[model samples]
Target: MSDQTTQRHPNILFILADNLGYGELGVYGGGPLRGAPTPHIDGLAAEGLRLTNMNMEPQCTPSRSSMLTGRHAIRSGTYAVPLGGVPEGLTQWEITLPKLLSDAGYATALYGKWHLGRDDGRLPNDQGFDEWYGIPRTTHETTWLTSPGYAPELVRPQHIMEGRKGEPSRELQVYDMQERRVIDAEITRRTVAFMEERARGHQPFYLFTSLTQPHFPTLPHPRFAGSTGKGDWADMLAEMDHNVGEMLAAIDRLGLRENTIVIFTSDNGAEFIKPWEGWAGPWRGAYFTALEGGLRVPFILRWPGQVPPGLTSDELVHGVDLFTTLATIAGVAIPQDRPIDGVNQCDLFQGTSAKSGRDGLLVWVDNRLQAVKWRNFKAHFYQQDTMMSPPEKLPVPFIIDLYTNPREEEGKRASGWVLEPMLKMVQAFEASLVEHPAIPMGTPDPYEPPRRCP
Candidate 1:
């Protein structure tokens, strides 16, 4: 971060969580009910914006890929979670948010959880970041690295790599479930160091600090363990909140509070794993389904003096919009060379307009477009009640008013009310594909040196 008087671009601090519920945050409706009171995360909503209708894809890799590139995961070759992260990710040609920022003279780094392929050409640093230190894939895949009592220790280790430009991505440690307990804190400390380094330098920084918690194997750090009476998941949320407060405080300490844009969001909705599943609040279904509970998430943005405080909007915003929005805020240009799915919602964020000015967002499960939502009505092409289960197809997409069936109990067949708008959205999506032509499926590249993957 730099002095406002001399700074050209605002620093971007994007915080993301794994399997965090929409109702898990105080603003979204979790907090004490979920056994974790998130004052710090709630504070972001209080002082900034909380998007009630913000949407993400139903799974992690797709949601994350869409967020970064502002392109559908199918187009980016990450529509589904890979077998230990294969088939490469996003391709070497795709332009990312960090890549844009880095090109525009801002320092870019990513700390924690990069599931976007770990091969030589697809890691965080390879994409656009200047420095990257984090897990290369999902947390569940590393359960074996955990201790016997804590998490199932693996025969093979998941490397926590430290990557920088011109140097090889170095393996710093093999993270276990025990490491997951305090990994957020470790990431926070590293992020604060990044901020400190940038504060003394001329270049502003963008740190995408993704936390690996509230996901499976949610082992909370010692202090936060059982802080929430509910269970390990609740305790993990509380710990994450504390780490968030620490990160925010560090920005203020560096006098970069007003010059930075802090965004807190999740990759997707709550996990569906029982005995460790998250509460989706009043909604039905969790990750890997076409339910609102799986796609909708908490999106909070705080930028002092730039974005107004205490503003809550239920306007339509999608995960893919991050790329264009961040680029606009940073005074950078969106890649005119490609068709980016993100819309520049700078006006909505600045509170200049009440509407998000978005047409709609598609609902996908892996490569299949399961549903399409426009306004309050949604048309479901497939009926899926659980993750990894076969979806039932309908003769016509089942259209439902999300308000009436918040739990996704059932839906009426499409009529003019739902069919008309849904058709438009579907046609638009089809046109976009016809115009740009996507490289839909590709096989995984061979695993690189230093480590082997299944």
Candidate 2:
């Protein structure tokens, strides 16, 4: 095929949900919940591939960083939430997905939350996204709810913004947390407009519509309020589902569905909020913990003819893999020198392979190495002193069977568990960690402590 014909790449649309879980959607067997149905998300799964064993970092920033850079979060030096401002954002050495796609003549834009970095040097414009409109920091808590008497300083700020189309300026706008009705609607409107504009343009585009709904403060638009019949959190999820439907509708109307690859996933698992049933379905624990519910997130990929409709795969994949897979689909070359922790799972999506493509996986939480999954077995490692101790000197590692027990329990043990593979994977992962140790917690480093606004 000629360069022009090869360059006629499929438009990529990645929709990310903050703190969404695997069992939250109807297609994931959450249909019996009292919430408003998620027909649109279910439709996407029915039309594409639903990955049953998708994993992410324990927190949002790290997971998103892994996705953007195709490397471990520690390698990017974005280990945890920023303290005050992001100094070392995504390393310039890292080749981001947008950068690769843009180089291949694809226009890229990010709408909604951007928790990766906040400083001008770390903004999306600096990190390969041609256009960005969302929170500079990780969450809205840093800007809106960080005040003394507001919610406990337990979470990061989750703000909102729009970039590349305004007056070449950046500013923060505050809104009532209870009144997300207006905010979400406006974001959807702007995102749809962006899609329509890109569809009319000469080049194919890659757009990331990151939603802040269903995160925390679990507030839904008034029109969707009580629509879920469950509670506040379910209502927020319903609103998020509606926004997704609107985006899909726009793609169909613009005559781009056939040539577009749409993916929907969450940064991590659910967080603490009312409607305890609103979050991760049938799984134990919420965010900030090293539980299956916290890391195993919802992953849906849709590519009309390329991906068989009504298909589900139990392959173990990570958010970071999307970078290489999309690059491969676009015929872009991924740099070989850098350390990228993701693989191209195009064959798995095609249903030709049952292999996970990954022999081992790593996860971090609050700047500490929390867990490692090797096939059916997983090991959990916790740091005694996150602020002072080196990761290698932390202590003995605990092992568990993810296939039998999703939760790491105290008394449960896998008898004569295959230690050779687990030990080898752990040594490899630890060797990589020594080269890039976990940033000590509670430090001035951007990846150590959670972002705190004064």
Model 1 regions lying over 4 Å from their true place: 1-6, 84-86, 145-155, 411-414, 443-454
Query: What is the lDDT for 301 in model 1?
Result: 97
Taking all chains together, each candidate's TM-score versus the true structure is 0.93, 0.86
Model 1 TM-score is: 0.93
Kindly list the per-residue Cα lDDT of model 2 for residues 158-227, writing each as its tens digit: 4455556223427656444543445667667877887788766646888888887766666778888888
Candidate 1, after superposition: displacement of residue 164 in Å? 0.3
lDDT per residue, candidate 1, 212-244, as tens digits?
988887678988877777778778888999999
